[model samples]
Target: MKEELIVKAYEVAKERYAAIGMDTDKAMDALQKVQLSLHCWQADDVTGFESAGELTGGIQATGNYPGKARNIEELRQDVLKAASYIPGNHRLNLHEIYGDFGGQFVDRDQVEPKHFESWMQWAAEHNMKLDFNSTSFSHPKSGSLSLSNPDKSIRDFWIEHTKRCRAIAEEMGKRQGDPCIMNLWIHDGSKDITVNRMKYREILKNSLDEIFATEYKNMKDCVESKVFGIGLESYTVGSSDFYTAYGASHNKIVTLDTGHFHPTESVADKLSSLLLFIPEVMLHVSRPVRWDSDHVTIMNDDTLDLCKEIVRCDALDRVHIGLDYFDASINRIGAYVIGSRATQKCMLQALLEPLDTLRKYEANDQGFERLALLEEAKSLPWNAVWDMFCLKNNVPVGEEFIAEVEKYEAEVTSKRN
Candidate 1:
């Protein structure tokens, strides 16, 4: 590791030691071990550490992660191995290896019941779990039955697929006794500003009803906060118009993508508000890049610090963490490797901070009100946290990225732009 990083690690360790009232020597020893583990895992590339290594280590592919262009078995192995990097503990609640909704266009039906059975066996060996979400049924070439067409046959086909997939998930979980969610998203929203909005409402309700009737009824149903496309339209799930439509006021929950909440609220505020409706958020943790660029960078200090605050408030147990990363610039393997490791590291640091901080508060004879006060004390701006981590890691933020962000000010930057 670089000398700067070593110093920074020591600083973090010293702060924790002081907070916990532990002897400096003991704190240093513990933090040193953590630091060394990080260095060994992330400092350099180890032999046989292929991006695909994640699955071989035992994680299962949950959703749209498989591509027509990739080998299913290979992708499955890489996902599992990526999961292995998570430190095991109830406190270390890194849920499942999550994938997006892109599989609608691919022929996943080829994997069949047999392939799922084999994969379940593989997951059992590694102690990993699988979680998945379906892409909007309306995407072109997704082969989704179109309720918009008002054809019963088309609608039935779509409903059948949903039911079959749910059954498959149930079967897998029954064997493994691990949790999984068959998440749903629909591209059903008015496209043209001049279009009749009522038509889209019918379409949305119909699709959701079909999903709700599936075999995965017992599993948690998560509605995504989308990044773009038709579903992001004014009446779509992520917009204000669809917020109520999302069943947010009901028992069903909504998932929050940290990067997706940009320009709306800082991650901390989003977490605070989101916790009210859905304690367990299906998170899409990635770097907040320019408009429409969901480049899967590791969690930065800004986001990590906010996530830490959320965890401190006991909001973590309510949510499951998913590495929702998709970056075409870097192949899937590189994206998964860097993004997964970075997220795990940030989670570790975030988890460690609060335990130490709370220990200090408790030892000081602080009451629960003081704990609330600690939350107030920890309420530093996201940018300040970002600066601290960047400084510690010697990570560079590019000027081009800054320029792209500036251009998005005052105007909505479309993905095409």
Candidate 2:
């Protein structure tokens, strides 16, 4: 898009929003501040550098998309390419598997900060911080149960691995001078009916108590929960209720993955309640097609509501935003750009809302007026403000990124062996 056209469109949009007592500049400023922690798994289809491995733990990234990143260098290059198109300085979220193993196999229990030394150096060079997750899935010992295992040896293995992961996150945080959000989500559940449900839950609670025994200053620990995994359709040891209570009592951050709940559930609705209790929240923003299918995120109602709730509750700094999808069916870099841009767009829309006017309408008990304004807000010129955001960030404006992504595929990714 031409620079003059973008500025002109933004000026018109600024006027339109001003009439309704909304500031487009403030909305754009807020949008730019949102640093989405892009997931590293998306570039390589969750195939980490830990050797050739198959995805397990009831999660899968289904696609035969060529040009997948084969190693650390390629993955980092792909991430930089994607970030070029996205606005704002962002963070990178990593699973423990994507370490600098250097062709040698390092067992999960033995992972350390040295394995990620090169990553920290690289992130420093490129101006990015990092977040982390403990890899409990896609391991031989990850047979249905991990932290909640009846087998003490297998359970201790994962516990050791998780502790090591926290140490690594702490190192990253110290290096970057920021708190790394270390999220712990175990795929420990039963695929079929189990009579020892109470026993497993008891064991899991004990395991968590052991794992979180130590305290770290540079990293925040968060517990995540899911309804169920693919094969594990019967019972989930760490359900939402479990994590919520655990987080509240322990004063730990809670992570809410968008695809982890039932279809009827609204993740946005949980924020107001969570704000009253938890110190902080981490968002794993993804699109779920019916179940826990990690599809690329878009500017849908779920996403808009999630962002709006953050703004409405005045929890912008308190809530950490992150992307959590790995769609290998399309261009990986393109997937990253699309999901990041879509999320920013939704946030932009939410920020542009004339909340004071709507609240007054509600305070006056004007129900129909509030409803009417909401429906009308949908057609506002938020897209023009979005275009201006891209303009200010010096990124490709509008559909211009489509051609640029294609060019990258033709010149770079498609040539990968």
lDDT of each: 0.44, 0.93
What is candidate 1's TM-score against the reference?
0.61
- Give me the candidate number with maximum lDDT: 2
In model 2, where do residues sit more than 4 Å from their true spots? none
Question: Per-prediction TM-score, please?
Answer: 0.61, 0.99
Worst 10 residues of 2 by lDDT: 285-294
Alpha carbon lDDT at 271, candidate 1: 61
Candidate 2: tens digits of C-alpha lDDT, residues 1-417? 388998998999999999999999988888778899999999999989986878999788889889999989999999999999998899999999999998999999999999999999999999999999999999999989999998999999999999999999999999999999999998888889978887888899899999899999999999999989878989999999999999999999999999899998999999999989999999999999986558999999999999999999989999999899999889999999999999999899999999999999999999999999999999999999998999889999999999999999999999996
List runs of model 1 lying over 4 Å from the truth.
1-16, 20-69, 80-115, 137-153, 214-218, 230-245, 262-264, 354-417
Per-residue alpha-carbon lDDT of model 1 for 1-417, expressed as tens digits? 444554565566556545544343442233222210111111111111112233211111222322212333434444433333332311111111222222332233222344355556665776555554443242232332243334655555555555555665666656657556555544433333525555645665566667676435335666664434422334332343354345565455566666555455566555666666653556656566555424565657655666576556666556666545445442334344466446645654554453655666688887784578456534322223333333333333222223332343213212212
Candidate 1 C-alpha error for residue 38, in Å: 19
Error of 1 at 375 (Å): 13
